[model samples]
Target: PEGSSLQACDEAARKLTEMILKEDGVASISTYVGESSPRFVLVIDPVQPRNNYAQLVVVAKDLKSRKNLEKKIKVLVEEQLPNVQSYSRSIPLGPPTPYPVMIRVSAPTDALAKEYAGKLKQVMLENKNVTMVRYDWMEKAPAVRVELDDDKLRQMGLTRKTVASALYAEISGYSISQYYEGDQAIDIVFRLEPKDHQSISDLGTMSIPTAKGAVQLNQVAYLSYENEDGMIWRRNLLPTITVNAGIADGVTGNDVTNQIMEASKEMRNKLPAGVTIEIGGPSEKSEDSLRSLLGPVPAMLVIMLILLMTMLKDVRKVIIVVCTAPLGIVGVILGLFLFNTPLGIMAEIGALALIGTIIRNSTVLVDQIDQHLAQGMPRLKAVTESVIVRFRPIMLTALTTVLGLIPMFPSDFWRGLAIAISCGLTVATLITLIVMPVIYCLIFNVGNEEK
Candidate 1:
């Protein structure tokens, strides 16, 4: 807590202010807390009034470098303000380099906002994962002040209203004329060149032609900078500043998140007592969805088995019929692989459908064979007879199912499901027609001969 980067940030601000004051021509330098960085306002005495501009604010890579550069002020702060705290050198739980890190510093007043921003900017520059950081929330743009002199305007014989009208007319043009050429229509308007209004000085120097003579705008009015008004828009209702870092090409989101957590932990230990850090993104959503889907798999398998038993009745018959379920599954998996379709909810639903249809086909054939055996036919004859009799219906049903699914294969959403089902039904039907009857006959013979 004593050596927190925040403390370093505070020290950096004091140092930066001193550095600004030390520079020649600087009339005044002030630092204020900002939502993102410390806001520095520098007033410079103009050597030439015409070329005078606001002070330049230079941001460092991190707080340490800023503090290092402003060493003179550090000594001054220690001498003058003994109670002022300097941030720790290390972070307790700081993330590794190239991981995104976000920090929130709340100020009770605007003065505090400006003060903290200066410190935050310094700390961010020192941290490695902090590649790009910004704080538009606290950084106010200088206001453009156009001071109109009544005496100068009276001398020019131009009223304030006319001056205001001319300024508006030159900056924002009004549409004047419209003309048509055959089917095309075009509009034309009058306005000054774009560069004429690019800066405050350009606006000050603009000449307006009136009845008396051309009057230079600067002669009537002076321009100065002012802070922009209104609070900045924020995402998720937090005066949040984000520091984005680019992960290396091979790094995964999880890896980057882990690295950031590690670094943040280190940073946290060094943080002043009250500071806290939180990390979140798309990775959280993925983890939740994966856990929800994973928990139901066993229940789904048991349900499918129950359904197989209910439809087939006999356990042996159910086994023979359910064996085709895997053949269908193999077909679906192969279809997914061949088409390069990643298995998703729709594909899984397609697999479930394939299971039902393939089992039905196998069940129908085996049931018929059992019926023939129950009617007193020999086991071998019953199987041969069942296959010969069921072949046409099985082939017909499979062909119809394949034809129905053919139209769905071209659609991206349905194609995966369609291809899986179509291939599964085709392969499973073939396996069921050949292997299922053989299994049925063997089971019946084994049981009957033993009895």
Candidate 2:
């Protein structure tokens, strides 16, 4: 609803709690006003500068996923409120934002922004991965339209300020004076008693002074209700509406983003001139972060491979070592799957680190095999001896690395990262030790050539 108030937000939150009050794992729903969030504003003051915004902070019983419960709460709120025809729910996704998808629709005017945002939101919902969708650029609420007649004002010898002051004093109220008691100070407010200004008709009875003396405000101005922007939002001085959504469980953020882009061609035809859409929020952030990290990946690989080649002087051995490095992912994939952990950026970084350690260990084992080969030992014996000689050292190195990350598994924040490195290194180390000899034998035909 456009022109919604702090009170209206509270009412919605109140009803949301009423609907989910009996649901299991619901602790409480705490609501506050004017912070641009529907639930849980993380600001310092209890209240900030007045805006038509607020949030409903919901606490659940321990570490429970209350996504379904939140969906039910939205359905109830929309059903009860006539103006609130649509509703969506999201919890704290923690730091950054809770919404899985946030896209910005910008246009020269509010109407265009609203139209584009609505269309984009609809397209996003078509993708099954997206569970909930809402846009901040619209308002369904009706505003109190107060218009003063200019001719009547001139005839009555009155100015706009006097009538505005009277209306402000009568309805919005005003601070008359302040009293200082010791070190404390308090405002003494004065205004028409609640009974006198409870309704529009009563407010019209307010008297404003003119050159000809006092006259009723209603006689000069007309008061009515009209639909308007229920909420106002802007970005970089351009009219923008942010469309956000709650994603379904097991759905990758990238998957939903790909759907939105694929649907964009058709969606663009519906948009008016001067309206444009920009991908944002988690989807945008993920793309950017991955791009930044991956930019140097090829160069890093080339440099590492070059260094390994220089040390071994054998391209086949270098290729064998690199192939064994990625065998660590077997453990990484299994660990996350067993723990039900989502693969995020942290996990990607951990994988990179694990690969680096694997290569270093492989290089050391390869050096031992080369040393024995230089002494004219049989290729088969040299490969067998190398494995036995490197096993204890490689195991101890992998053991320390895994032990260091042991505490991270129990942590919510670091678990994804720790699981990737710890499990990947453990599995890769064992595989590399056992498989390197076979890789060396196959690549060089070491035993056959020696015979």
Best by TM-score: 2
Candidate 2 TM-score to native: 0.76
Off by over 4 Å in 2: 1-61, 64-94, 148-166, 178-187, 193-205, 218-224, 252-254, 268-273, 291-331, 378-381, 403-407, 434-451
**Can you write out model 2's per-residue Cα lDDT over 304-372, one digit (the tens) per residue?**
988888888989989888988888889899888888887777787888788789888888888998899
Q: How many angstroms is residue 441 displaced in model 1 relative to the true structure, after the best TM-score fit? A: 4.4
Cα distance off (Å), candidate 1, residue 429? 1.2
Tell me the whole-model lDDT of each prediction, alpha carbons only. 0.60, 0.77
Alpha carbon deviation, residue 397, candidate 1 (Å): 1.2
- TM-score of each model, paired residue for residue: 0.38, 0.76
After the best TM-score superposition of candidate 1, give how far the Cα of residue 269 lies from its true spot, in angstroms: 21
Tell me the number of clashing residue pairs for each predicted model. 43, 16
Report lDDT (Cα) of residue 338, candidate 2.
86
lDDT for 451 (candidate 1): 60
